[model samples]
Target: MKYQDSLEQASEKAAQVKVFLQRAGLAAHPVNYAVCYDYISGHHAALCTAIEHKLSAKTPFDDFIMADLYSRYLTPANPQQEQLLQDASGIVSRLTGYTDLAAEQVADYLQQLDFSLLQLQQQQQNGENILSAVEQLRQQTQEFRSGQYQLQQQLEQANQQSHQLRHELEQLKLQRQLDPLTGLYNRSAMQHQLELWFTEQPGRRVAAIAIDLDHFSRFNQDYGSAIGDVILSKVARKISSYVQSSGLPVRAGGEEFLILLPDVDLRSASEIAEQVRRGVEKLRFVSARSKKALPKVTISLGVSLYQHSENWYQFLARTTDVLTLAKQRGRNQVASETMLALPA
Candidate 1:
């Protein structure tokens, strides 16, 4: 009965060691075989020494026992132990193959993850570049808008200056076409007016009258030139007041004047010219220094009606010739080219 109890206690202790080895993740078959053989062969000191070394080396009990069995008992001469070592070697080789395959799979997975991270980083960089380009475009647009606004303001100022210049040009043109002393149309203005009228309405009844201040040089000698100027001004004012209401009066020369009458025949023009001569003969001028009545001013008039075939120059020449005849015949009288003889 005591032998049975000792056997049970030894069996229980061996079972506890097996459990401890298995829990430590060591091979069960190799460790159990090695421990049993060592005990049966009376090499208990070898087992104890191996366990102590394994404990010192921090090795699992089962792996320590397996290494001991191969080193001490599993040799080529012992065929049974060699066969057991071969089985253990087979199991370890299979386990190494599985471990190597698992390591390869893990390495491949890590490589794929690295490639994916690289692609994501590249996409992020592209997005940042696009944002930078958008900001640059916005700044350019703002600058362009500012430039356009300044251009618009400059254009408006230029337009205003152009308008003011045009108005000044018109005033200058008017001053050039007017006689400063008489306030009437000058000779150039008269010629231009006749030409414009003829072009606009051809074959119209138009008449030209030429008038001369009778004895102007004699009046300038007798009275001072200043008094003579007053007399001439008075005569010009009377003639302008009479003719400008019905026709156009122009200062033709120093002491000569011309009138242009549109839609008037030679008979009506002669009547108007005689009326102007009488009006001028009745003009009274006063000397500024003396404050006395000056001599009466008289003008001789000549008239010529425009012919459709004649230009402005030919008509004026004919009227001037008649004016010469009137001056030779008598002063303060009117004559026409049709009624007078040609100059000798």
Candidate 2:
């Protein structure tokens, strides 16, 4: 799909997500939308899978789940932010110290002024000169101004430090949303997108395709962990390319993936899943040390279209179950809910 088309699709998905949340009586906060959006977008495999499980079992969509999702995907680096806030807090403490010092100085000067006033009264009663009393009062006034000047200087320094730290904190939060390993968005970013999609366009259709590698454990056993990793990277690249710009590719876990295609139908989505299966089967990974071709790899996929009456969790769980069925009936096949259904 064209870049513009891709952008439009995301917008539509976010709107649909919002509607889904509203219908289900879930909170529609950005954090909630973010978690749902990421799941719907297929950015956070584990998160989407968890949500799917909840829906499949007709579990309650409670606040605890939402809070967990919010912290994981939407606000993963709060501790870092908290650390910066702590630094700001230190500045506040220092500012308070400066304030206290100024207060003490002011209080001392007031006492001195009171003494000066008493001295002037004595001078008047005894008919003596009052010049010393006036001089003392002037000195106290100058001392107070000097104290204020020092406090203002400290305040400016504190403000500058707080401002710089806030800017750095923002940058860290933005970078946290992207997964460094896969280059796709992390769970948090996907969650953000999901919320945005449903909040704006809740009626659009969504489809999920779950893919899991067959015999992945055998590869790890035969060639060591390093070789297994190579296979995973290659397979992930293939799946990502097959889905391309039109869909979201997620590395759900070891040897498992999910592709989310919004506004897509079962037939078309199944074809895409089948294509990925074939492409993976064709991949040839060579052992660097032995200079020999390694064992062949295959995948099983399950596809399911969204049903409005069903919760997001349920919709994904149904898709995952279908994928599991593909593995059971011999691996390396594409299966879906429609394919496993009984005739009317």
Best by lDDT: 2
What tens-digit string does per-residue lDDT give for candidate 2 at 1-344? 21233777888877888886876667676567777777677767788888888789768664335645656555555687778778878978988898889789888888888888999999999999888879878988898888889889988888898788778877776666544455444545544555565667787677788888898878799899888877777788888887757567876545667788877888989999989999999998889999999878999999999887875656666777788789888889999787677432
> How does residue 11 of candidate 2 score in lDDT?
86
Consecutive 10-residue window with the lowest summed lDDT within model 2: 178-187
Candidate 1 lDDT tens digits, 293-324: 87777888889888878666567767877887
Clashes of 2: 26
Candidate 2 stretches with Cα past 4 Å from truth are: 1-175, 178-180, 186-188, 342-344
lDDT of 1 at 151: 51
For each of the candidates, the C-alpha root-mean-square deviation to the true structure, in angstroms, is: 63.1, 14.6
lDDT of each: 0.69, 0.76
